[model samples]
Target: MQRQSIPALTMALGSTIVLALLGGCTSVTPPAEPVDVVISGGTVYDGSGGEPYLGDVAMRGDRIVYVGPQRDLAARRTIDARGMIVAPGFIDPHTHAEVFLNSPDPEQRVNAAWLAQGVSTVMIGVDGGGSPDIAQAADRLETGGIGTNAVPFVGFGAVRSRVMGEEDRTPSGAELAAMKELVAQAMCDGGRGFSTGLFYAPQSFAETGEVIEIAREAAIRGGIYDTHQRDESSYSIGLLASVAEVIRIGRETGMPVHIAHIKALGVDVQGQAPAVIAMVEKARAQGIEVTADQYPWLASGTSLEASLLPPWALDGGNDALRLRLAQPDERARMKADMAENLRRRGGASAMLLTSPDLAWTGKTLAQMADLQGGNAVDTALAIIARSLEHGGGQTNVASFNMAHSDVDLFMRQPWVVTASDGSNGHPRMYATYPEKYDAYVLDRRTIDLGNFIRQSTGKVADIYGIEERGYLKSGYFADVLVFDPGGYAPRADYLNPRELATGVTALFVNGALAVENSNPTGTTAGRVLLRPAPANCQVRPR
Candidate 1:
């Protein structure tokens, strides 16, 4: 113990030399020779926004090995895709399927609803409600065997709750460190990025600095930042400012940013679509990577409590809010504030209750209130009180808070991609893609079909950095959809929301038929996409 002395610089240099040598020799071995699955005689869009062409695609195991004339391909299985448009399976960039998977219903777990809509892959844990155990969840689903590939985001709310409990406050120094470590662990566990609903409780308490710090970790780890920004409604620190915050995060932290469910909500921000678009474009011009998703409808959905009550009333948790609602004077003030919130959102008539009791499912708030023999605000309060009493906090409600014209304006932007913000909300789960195709492509002709396909596929894949997906190249994932363009349309409406969309004939997930002849084959062939670190960042193929 006393005899040997090591030279500090010499040892350090020796270790560095050893690491450099190891790094220089590191290489990825090519996958073993793949099993071929051939798809023949199809009109392929390829998801690249390139023109549709007649060709055949050959798949080797889970990846596409060939996409050419299909003249000389031999395979164990051949799908006759003649007269169908074979393109990359749609990627839903924003979804809440993680919550559904936690449900007791088996149907909810697999999310066959999305599968029927030609969605082969989904990004789950959006809007501040995801989990750190996303890999375990994916494994559970894979082990249990479900349809569709799912990638998850580490949620801001979940991380905040873990670090700060249910209280609304800024993180203490140690808590901030804990939150950062949780985020890093989540990324290391296979999360694609971080998602925040800054408008929601717990997360709403987070200051911009805290968000930037956590997002910077994600960026360094090669993850994107997706946000449901602080506000989407009023011009006062709303749409423009919120969009600016996303851009600021991207610039400051060097993370690519995606604005979740980007919209100009409420009448105040109605005609401000162009201004918002200009803000995004300006940020892009300054070399900030920013993009957004829209749901193809004017109305948006959220918890009734969050939508109606002022942010202050929601400061603490459900218990504090219930106490305030019990006091007569506080109740009166809360009602007044809620009325103002309703007015800001358009009107009571504009609000539709998507989930109350099963009986109230399809009713508008005004109608439900009328049935309850009181004003809409009182009825909403009653529902909230009853839900609290029954241990059912925060019923889901849809506010007709968007301008159809504004939606059209946003959809026309080249950088704007399509998403459902998919959740229990009817349109998101049922009609998101087909509705966009029907509305923008077929009905109004605002955007051509090619652009629609591009927005749904390659554009989203490019934005989120999904590998070998969202395209039909010679060597890509064989996640493909075959649909009749003329027949494609969303069949679900607000009243009957759970209806499966029609017109997609077949879907292939990892070269295995997932949806066959308008039916789900119930195959779970999706792989968890663990993106490389920033130092080895792969530019997602265009």
Candidate 2:
């Protein structure tokens, strides 16, 4: 039988007595501490490559102060994150966002698309392209008010061009000394590392010995070596040899090495993921810290010239290449070389032209050829010539050169981190993280949620030695994200490359709200991250 409820006074007195007995005469427990922001009632993934747990996260100023069940914690602002996943904000280890960041337009400066994907930091000056004057570049980016935090890399190409021009020859003793000085100065000026697009001209002309010597400067100053290795296809040295070159650089320099956009690019190199992985594994076993990054898509974005022109053709520079193309004999030789290059790239049908100057921004090379009533090679040549004449620098192409199996294989490796390598005219620029999250983690189930987050967040931060970020832990920077796990996905695609993604509910960069309820707050709270001294670099023996 149900007993009548005790009187209000008796009930209150009984609870007080119970609490006192439980505490054994100790003072009453204090109320939870106050915080600046509290994200309550959510599943938390701490970015440690472990299972998520239900908990609360509290932040004050720019750092996380509490991460657990904090029912009594008081915050000036509370975000009810019920049924959502709360995790550390994603970090893009490789990106070209600096171009957009430097734009005078406020909308462009906000970097809203990437912010919506929960990216709080981007490592820029990648693929060997940033000002050699690191301090000046950092100052400009800082003054511009970017939305995502930025870290600068000193470009090997930029330095090489500065000292040697576009000529393809070994540097003289004085020139080599000058280049080394530039690298050291840039590192001192807050560059995170040395970045080289050795796959492209000028840098490609540099022998492996030269790269190792230049990278040594960064290594001594506490910087990693990040590279678009000399070749990813059967281009000159082949992908396997390029991987070995990267390992040699790391070994000689005594610094960590990172391969940008690691992949089995092109049909010639497809299905070689195992070989590539083995090389990297051997390097790691020898105590050299080696890692790589990849985007989710099968297609890789590059300028039309980069896709088809042999490194030798670009020896003198753009002007020289154009001059050569004008000569009938040189044009004939270039056409033959381009035919083989196109075949290695999986044929013209697989290459989609995304250049704005041409009328065929979304058409495949085959389609463009058909439209122009010409063969694929001739059509490609015509497009390049037109782009040079009146279009622009170089028309963009999305080369569908990767194998799905190879992409999956590389992605499963623990050392492989996620990166956008994102730039304008490609959907990857807007949708990289979400595509990986949705396609691989949710739909394909190739990777679990915790591992996916780890690859994109903590792993990247750890690899780059970014300070006080990439984890939801006490005393860490409060760059955080809250999103609907089931609904979070990318909306951008090839046809509509600029469409912003959907499903992020809230995002915070340095404790400032950048996005709320899937809408932008128009806040630019990003900071310029400097290279932490190499003492923190992870160097472990196998």
Candidate 3:
């Protein structure tokens, strides 16, 4: 073969470079690559914690093929996203979306509340309520066709309760061993980690030492220790001590520690967010992995039982509590304790009924007491008694114990990402991202729009170790959304807590359009997200 002339070679190389650049402003699939969907001409927030840019995102199947300047690529669908903010679909680090995910109704299982809020993924099995049967749960989620992706954490309380019934005592050697085995099995079966609601009973019964021991199994299997903590208020060891306990747990186990819905709960702990932030930063500085999630709400929801009853009194579940309430002296003792708890939660007027009893759903505890012609304590006891008689879990309240200042302080922290400790009877279940964006980002400018998106998207995915789904980058999964900033705000409020949020123009889960024209397309494109199995993971024992 004859060698080409220098001018011919230079021209050929120049043409190749021009073609590469024309593929898109960034490295992308060739122009010949088929794009299933093209979201064009939008302000793109790539979830990189960076400034927004005007760009296009092309999707093919379940993956993003390109993200760059306007491309003249052919696509099956084209969305004119002009005047909208196009970003990675938000990832919620903590949520009780299980209520929807586990619903027998297919519509409920579609998880529209979260999908409407632009959430592509949610962490379920939160607050120590996860099942150890991770495989079974994953199978159900996949086969049932959910509306948003889910990550499951094997719960410490779930295993502990199964191994040892609801008792306020130390676990025997065999029981402890059994619980550890369950944690190992769950982790091996693809659970995220060991989660805890140590403030709740049976779980509360286990000492921190016991928890550290059980959580080590998760650590060994490369799982993070996610907790609702042992205390978030002046209950038990107090808030600061609780933070320290989590830090120590992380340090001791050599695992990451995530404080679920980290906050200064109750009057005694109000205005303590700064200190908590400092503690977490210090731990992080020490090379201990410590991250936290926070909801934007001033009120935290819980059952009357979880809020007012003492952990000891809650021992052995509602049956034991029923027996205790049946005894006059025991009832008197419980009332005294509950009265203090009510005060700690900022008085009876601050507790708003949220569910079950329609007649009293919107009333405060004080209002209910006044109408019932009884003191707050007596009214609370009566409600608890009635719930127990009806097989329990009938009462829930939104306790307005957090201060705006504290919430703001927590939100401003770099490590504190957005999450909804979402549950039934709370507006957060339907609208947390919009609420934060509307009130915190747009109104107060507490953090800029970029910060809000980062906190809600990449930051959460990074913290949870979810691979390849939080950013609109080349080769990432196509979990993307388009929203109108002017209209993306929460519809749900304290009084009307179930309304779906508005202003999501389009949402795609795994490259399938789940929402179009701000309406659900009724596509169940969600999957059970799983990380790579830990190298140390062992087969679960039979």
Candidate 4:
């Protein structure tokens, strides 16, 4: 200024005075020691496919600074982890936590149901139901304080619904453009990837070319494409062709493809697991980025409408579909198609109502039919008609459509990672991790403890490109779990679906204790994970 401005002069004087006081204070006081939290005397698995070893892990602030013998180290908190298995917290690759958040109970908020099982992170918005406002949802969860961290994948169904309702037709040029714009906006807003459910309404109408074009947009942004493929049971298009489509998209667009709930449903598809595995192996051999996730259970859960109705019958939303159901001519066509679909799904006797009328819970379609003195087909149609009348409410049903041999073969594959496919009606939400450990590792002895943990943690993290997490490494984010391996078990069953699992003792997120002594601290220390972000985005072992 012409003369130094008064405020600028005051700032200069203040800076000089502040610097002098800081110097005096620094000289007068000794430097404070580093803040470290230590976990002592435990078997460390580390999640790197390494042999387990006994050691102590030390954390400074939110990062792990040391992982070795702790005789000479000092810390503010020293946790005794004797007789416990210390590993990276489990990451559930597929979940429906977004729906649970719609409820108002704080205890039920963000699915603390998974926390006690040592799951610190969950991938939500799967099966074509993730939100476009992913960043805003993450902010809300963080502000509300969730018990576990969550990452969202933008759903094609939600995007399509926004662009064109549930109409059963191809998207026009303008509609397609609007869809692409919405996807781009979601990705820019921190969505990890794009997901689609081809078996569901609206999305079912999309041709392969449409899916490929949209997938390319996500690929450009370094996102993955996950799908509930069009068919998993029959050799019509077959599992091979379905998997091939996913691989082709990845190869063409340079994006990774993940197959959700990899399985061959129905007796005809039994023993076909090896062929599917070989196909995935060959794709990976050719340098296509491909992977898959599976829930341990043989039975799968979905809505009664999804599992039974022909795709065309569900083309429009509830109102239009109900109108079609009301016409006798339309009703006969739908009933015939429903009969064939039910048979293709292994019959109504194999289908159990997961979330029906309170009076019908645990009853099979066959049982309901018998009680009403009508055939199973009629009973099933009546249930769907009632649900449509209620404005398209969701009803859960379990399909006993998978084969045991197929389940074992998939579980043994080195590349097959574990996911819950967890949701409201499915017991996987409450029991996936522990159930896998108990069934595949303990009961079947198909995989060892080390291999199982690797599949659940490190392998999943690698597939999704999650950094620093899924391993116990120095200078990584301090997301850790301590559990009694011998004491671990799952308590929930289909009949008692809401019970919690047992044996995880402590869980830490970002150096803060989120779960202590099998109890949640009710703190939401989770962060939103965006694509192309560095590995330092998560808490890992030091």
Report every candidate's CA lDDT: 0.78, 0.84, 0.87, 0.77
**Clashing residue pairs in candidate 2 (N, C-alpha, C atoms within 3 angstroms):** none
lDDT of 3 by residue, 200-300 (tens): 88889888899999999989888888999989999889999999999999999999999999889998989888898889899999999999989999999
Off by over 4 Å in 3: 1-30, 540-542
Off by over 4 Å in 1: 1-36, 103-107, 533-542
Question: All predictions: root-mean-square deviation over Cα?
Answer: 14.5, 9.1, 9.2, 14.4
What tens-digit string does per-residue lDDT give for candidate 1 at 1-542?
Answer: 11112233123223432333233221223224544666777766667775565667777877787775545555777778775667889999987766555556655656677877898888888888777665576567676655678878999999888778767677789999988888887776667999999988888788898999988778888889999998898623777888888889999999889998889899878889899899999999999888898889877988888888777777767888888999999999999988988888888788888873466788888898889899989988988888888785578877888877888888999888888887675566778998887777666767776777888899999998898899987578889898866566787887777788887888888888888766777666665565554543333221
- Score every model by TM-score: 0.89, 0.92, 0.94, 0.89
lDDT at residue 46 of model 3 (Cα atoms): 87
Model 2, 223-338: lDDT tens digits are 98999988899988999998999999999999999999999889898999999999999999999999999999999999888899878888888788889988999999998999
Candidate 4 weakest ten by summed lDDT: 22-31
lDDT by residue for model 4 (1-542), tens: 12234344224323432332232211112113545677877767778776665677777877777665434456888889876778888888888866655446666774677887788888988877887777677677776666677878999999999989999998999998888877776777777899988768888788888888887767777788988887787624767787777788788888899989999987667788888999899989999888888999978988888877777777778878888888999889988988877887888888988883466688888899999999987888888877776776877888888887888888888777889888777788888998988787766767777787888888989988887888877777888888876666788888777777887878888777877876777766766666653332331211
* Clash pairs (backbone) in predicted model 1: none
**What's the lDDT for residue 351 in model 1?**
86
Score candidate 3 by TM-score against the native: 0.94
Candidate 4 residue runs with Cα over 4 Å from true position: 1-36, 70-72, 532-542
